[model samples]
Target: MRYASITERLASLGSEKWAVHVEARRRKGQGEPIIELTIGEPDLPPHQSLLEEATRAMHAGRYRYSNGRGEPPVVEALVRKYARRRPDVTSANVLCFPGTQTALFAVMLGLVEKGDAVLVGDPLYATYEGVIRATGAEQVTVPLRPEHGFHMQADDLERSITPQSRVLLLNTPHNPTGAVLTADEIAAIGEVCRRHDLWIVCDEVYEELVFSGSFASPFDDPELAERTIVCSSISKSHAAPGFRSGWAIGPAEFASRLLAVSETMLFGVQPFIADMTAYALDNPIDTSARMRQSYKSRADQVIAGLADAPGLTPVAPEAGMFIVVDVSATGMDGEAFAWALLDEEQVAVMPGSAFGSGGDDFIRISLTVPDEMIDEACRRVSALAMRSGVRKELRA
Candidate 1:
């Protein structure tokens, strides 16, 4: 029997990238003392006020279906939050979804399709390729070199554009690498997009997770507002990933046009969740601030622990909860080293190859674990790297 082309396009795009993570989970289920650090789940809980708000709304009968656009209160809250970033932002500019993932899917569908090209950075978030491929668009990967701090270079973006290019998918406080783009960097990339008439779809899910840099986005620039759409959620900012509350801020017309696509899949997010999301945006909380401190400290711990280890160099993240370590000098690629570390040291980490070729020599470590756990994990990783380095030297 034949299947839709989308099925073929997305065949290995999902859980396949998470092979190491899946293996680690299986081992842990069997009672292995695994220091799991593969995914980016927050170690913190949702703010108490946000939780209470959801419960209150649910008890008040907010379980019913919502409109295609979003719950009114949620839209209003989002407007006020974003209006500070771009003063002209209004309810019309917002479209709520279950999370940044869904918002991105809807936005991509509205912007590109078969025969078009979507320019995205290499070493992008694991799900980005699947999202773009699902739309039948060709994904043109622009190399994000580590030497440049993994931030997407405007020159590289411009070099990758072709006549078929329709959009530039960007992520700040970037996943895997945690590289945040500066205001000047954003303006440069925006200029490239403007020159080519490409839409900029930025995944700002980690917007509030910055540790060492100021955050900026194309959406914040008035000249780029019409072409920029920002997708974000309370997942990281409020420590509420399970709530599945997120939205897209874009040109009103784009949001209006995408409403049909969003409705076709999921008409709206849960009303109770919407209420909680609204509360999250309207009230400034310390959740993100706390996370910023914890994640940064944990990352520093790992980097410091590995400082004396042979052949392992942990890259400092400017933002976000994950840090990458270059393990190429140990005479093994990231996948091999990751499995070896799990088997020998009982530590689980995602191989850089899971992201893309750009990350082939690296392994990503999540900073969501406690300090003690991070310390132990760091020690284990350092030990493994030391052993691997010795083995390489002996072979030489």
Candidate 2:
């Protein structure tokens, strides 16, 4: 039995959260009332307009293979999106993809050749290093210090770049940590990228879901405008992950290459999905108000609940919808704690180490669950902490 050598690459990139989540699902099948907060799935309905537009397109027989690059409407919609804030980019700068996850890889693969380095933030989204490795590029990480509210600093990037570094990957409204980089930070970072001659890739997937304040991007920075590539998805804003609607916007030359790669890789997204996504982006919704209201309420509940927890401290997020709790005092690594909590209390959360070793002493909790569910999960988390012998102290 001969297997492909490329299959070895898969081992470098499996999500540990899914293994724990599957077990939680199995327990639920056996009648356990488990609360699974391991994945960043928003428990909300997709927008009515998105649904209607997709249905309209499908029924109107607009379901054929796309123009082999992008449905014109979808590409143009992405253009108008950037135009609202980044008038520098025209329709030629947009490249549509099946999903933002693929766009992440496509940009790296399309731009940086093997042996070049892709610099990223420590404790980043789990797949980042894997994607870099698969592209045969070295993944260099700049530390995002807890002292700095887990935000990526420009000085850090300035010091980390070596001669081989070719790309700088930035995630605003970051995953796992939930930290949003400010406009000043973006500009400063872009200055560093410009000085060092690095291609900047900003993953703004959660751009529209910022809970506390407005979002900004370096793509809007004129200094780095030519060197920056911004990739995002309709999945988060529309609450329609299954639609597989995503795109990349960069310089005209790079965007053309990115589209060529995207077409060679996935041959463009389904026309109906792209049409729905275009409609969602063109006729934007004030979903930020809705997200801010719901997520803040839920985040406040989690933060308040963890205040009484024995050995955990929930870091208050500035924007994105996750609470990363420092659990070093628990005398257990995040993976051990997450499994124990799931087995003993039927509550599922992601082990922070899966994000990176920087998160080994922490755990990430999503605010996607209902208020009551988070209450129960936090109660279980507090109980787990108490087992480390702080029960009497915490109760008192």
The candidate scoring highest on TM-score is 1
Q: What is the clash tally of candidate 1?
A: 0
True-vs-predicted CA distance for residue 64, candidate 2, Å:
0.7
> What residue pairs are clashing in model 1?
none
Q: How high is the CA lDDT of each candidate model?
A: 0.93, 0.83
lDDT of 1 by residue, 10-80 (tens): 99999999998999999999999999999999999998899899999999999999999999999999999
Q: What is the C-alpha RMSD of each candidate to the true structure, in Å?
A: 0.9, 2.5
* Model 2 lDDT tens row, 153-250: 99998889999999998898888888999999988898888888999999998887787667888888777888999989977777777877888889
